[model samples]
Target chain A: MHNTLLTTHYPQLTTQQKNTMNKIQILVIGRDADILQAVVRLVNKNEHWNATGTSEDESAIELFHQHSYELVLLGGGIASDSELKLRKIFTLQNPDIKIIQHWGGGSGLLKNEIQSALENNEGGNFNIVDNPFN
Target chain B: MANTVLHKADTRGDANHGWLHSKHTFSFANYYNPERMHFGVLRVLNDDTVAGGKGFGTHPHDNMEIISIPLEGDLEHKDSMGNVAVIKNGEIQVMSAGTGIQHSEYNKSNNSTVKFLQIWVFPNKKNVTPRYDQIPLNLEDRKNKLQQILSPNPDDAGVWIHQNAWFHIANFDKGITTEYQFKAKGNGLYVFNLKGDLTVDGQLLNTRDGFGIWDTDKVQITAETDAEFLLMEVPMAM
Candidate 1:
């Protein structure tokens, strides 16, 4: 049933490709809807990357459990208490998941942060370039 | 039988960056191994050597329990918390980066290298007020016996962090044997052989080897030579 669902949804992907297919999934949580959506869009612009944004803690937790997210981006405007609780919950569920606190930064810096984190996890060199997206 | 995992010294990831050379016993910066990401709540174990007058620049960390044990030379530390200090051999340092903190460390000497162990453990609490502590250790106290160095209680022997973990170090003569009992029911123990040969739960380990065991209350360790090692007891579940 799972294979059938995958084939139906992704008809162009061969069995070998499907078996090796791995997308970088990110969960973006913030209090501001506009910035959250913008961040999601920016992340989606990267190839093989997918992001889902939510403004509510409950919804974020639900989405987290529903998807196998490798990273969580905690955007600005979240209360310290909420951030703490969310971090605890997320870590409890996935001990290896990387949680990044995203303060106010331009798209270039944001992208670099995400890239650095992913590369760091994959044992690659972490290099921060100045405004590559610009 | 106790569950166990072994990591030989040569299998560790090595990085050489001119001024610094480091070996990662587990996944660390530029040394990711999916299967070796961590052993329970015990995250990072880095054996590092810094060239004289050179060290890590200012960097930020948050929500981690960072501990350092200097083996040789002197390491000068400066942090945003307005604390500056030098830690040498026979000392341990710990920083609880609760909310966030920035710190830097450099070798204090101009001609001698500084060797140390940098370890990171997952804190049980979040958003804790950041704090730092370091203490000099009595080297003679660890001869042929375990000397507690770090624990969850600040009032205890060594520095404390925001985690349910205990760390101990010992130097033993050949033919000496000892048994270590777990502090907490669900906690596991990671044994790191600093020098010389040893056997833990019947597994032979040489210098720089790492052994992790759990699901048992106690284990026996025997020194095959005059040996020094560290024992880290941490929760098996996060």
Candidate 2:
């Protein structure tokens, strides 16, 4: 994967000390071309998610490590497995940071695995998918 | 004087017809309050729950962006656009109600209660063809984190809205802090704590409580404990 990010450091946010910006900063990682394209289209509609960057480049890890973000989305296939990728995420990202790993097609945590882990991992906050939107 | 925005999550106009119970986040047509017309482009947020073997009959809408998020059960949807789909738990669905369209949704389960959220946003562009899209969010994406669920541009994953708003859902771990930045210029974030406790803009927000700040570009949110929250950033001078 080419390092498109190396040439461009996260744009130096204008130094103006204007009022605090309320946009939600996000970092998305994945290989699904359609999904990444969809994000570009969607961000055009939502003025709230100030999307910082979307990467299919294997350099997603370095990009995430070097920048400061509010949320990060790990698209499917970025890594081989879940546990290994998750560990890498926590190690480099801020302790209070947010991340979402979109398992591309199928493979990763099983349903039971997620259910069981939810209880302990969430620290008692359960908004577990209780409904569906169609 | 404008009417007060009747946005209390609990003190809402409700309709329960056995099969479903819906609470209007803001005033609806028949339940109108002049002041409650809207808070920016955030027109409607109806908290709906459907009973087993029951759901909404086919309905028609136009010139809006409709998003349905099932919080509890499964949702079976059929649209006049020849679209048949099911949005199960953890799924985020969006329909551009442009150029008018008709659709029906039902609870696909037999003995389970279905709870969901219906949020409406004003469109940036008018009269585009009606369209539909859905995405199944993964457990890892939302596990102990806030997921970007809605954006105006449709560039990232998840669903797209037609307006200058973004909706993010997250399940925060104990003592985790998250940050948010607005996409549009001159916009700000309004933090809504759905469950648990949260501190945004340095103020504590309990379940169902919301605090909004405008004229700012970015804000920080820290969870005192495990929590679920939604952040809405919209233009203030609209």
Candidate 3:
């Protein structure tokens, strides 16, 4: 989410952020646009997507309540805290929202999807990758 | 500056069909440029903008890691690998078009234009028989955070790319500071700020400003104002 106090003076600053922000009103908290756009673009096609409105992850929760969004996307990788802080906020602020995360070089989600697909569907895209050079 | 083989991509032929406008970052069929082949194993960087109701017809790919990141609007993806996904902003989908695969991308929205970034990376090992995986990210986690979108490991939170690199997205509040540690062994990060203002190690990065820092252990970013940035931590060389 953006700074609430300072952003009032620069209207164009908001406009510039809008250029890269998605249809969802977002606050790129700790992550950047690539991840935000990556998620917003992945979820819904709502014309109102504007995740750039909030510059801090903490502030975006209020924005979500003020309007509404199909999903809330975040970057993974907890910085040594063992437990996650944002996960709890998402659970409390918008329990109805879906939270998607991937960290440790992006390993958790991919692994879960692979395991689930394998368990549920036998013939899926999972396969042993062969050497291209060979 | 971290060591990067800058292949000032030579122009490749493109297709503009009113609805879909795609420009290949590297040489493609009917538009070949050997020198513009690829930067290391980074094969294709296609910038595509699909009209409100237009998109690409069915196409085929093989033995490559295909990643689609929507810059704006929604991208409807249907593949022979039995996957139909829509990837948009802040989201990423990985397709191991191994052996051979057929797929098509279209704009699902009726009135909104769909802008997306499609990238191709060579696999560590090829011929993986084809696969598809998509993940939608949350903005809250990324608030002042660097969220990982793709990597080689399947267990990572976001999508998976076949290369030995990691893609991270983080939007920083003005005067907000953050740090990024290397995600892979012997790998470094390349920072590209698509929008807003950011300073890394006292170096200012504006729109499209790029920074390649390697051999170091971590990267620290402090935004002068509300900013959106991308981080690609890959091998220092091919």
Top DockQ model:
1
lDDT (10s digit) by residue, model 2, range B1-238: 1111213456666767688788765555234334443456665666789998788666555546788988888999998789999888789899986655668899999899889887776566545678999998885786677688888777975778777778888888878986777788866566667788888767777776656676666777888878888777765543
Each candidate's chain A: what TM-score? 0.72, 0.51, 0.38
True contacts kept of each: 0.00, 0.00, 0.00
| Span of ten consecutive residues with least summed lDDT in model 1 chain A | A1-10
Worst 10 residues of 3 chain A by lDDT: A101-110
The DockQ figures for the candidates are: 0.06, 0.01, 0.01
Q: Which portions of model 3 miss their true places by more than 4 Å? A: A1-134, B4-17, B22-39, B201-203
Question: Which candidate do you rate higher for TM-score, 1 or 2?
Answer: 1
Which window of ten consecutive residues has the lowest lDDT sum in model 3 chain B? B4-13
In model 1 chain B, which range of ten residues has the least summed lDDT? B28-37
Give the winner by TM-score.
1
In order, the B-chain TM-scores come to 0.99, 0.89, 0.82
Expressed as tens digits, the lDDT of each residue in B13-68 for candidate 3 is 47676886767655543344444444445555666788987787665554567788
User: Can you give the TM-score per candidate against the true fold?
Assistant: 0.72, 0.59, 0.56
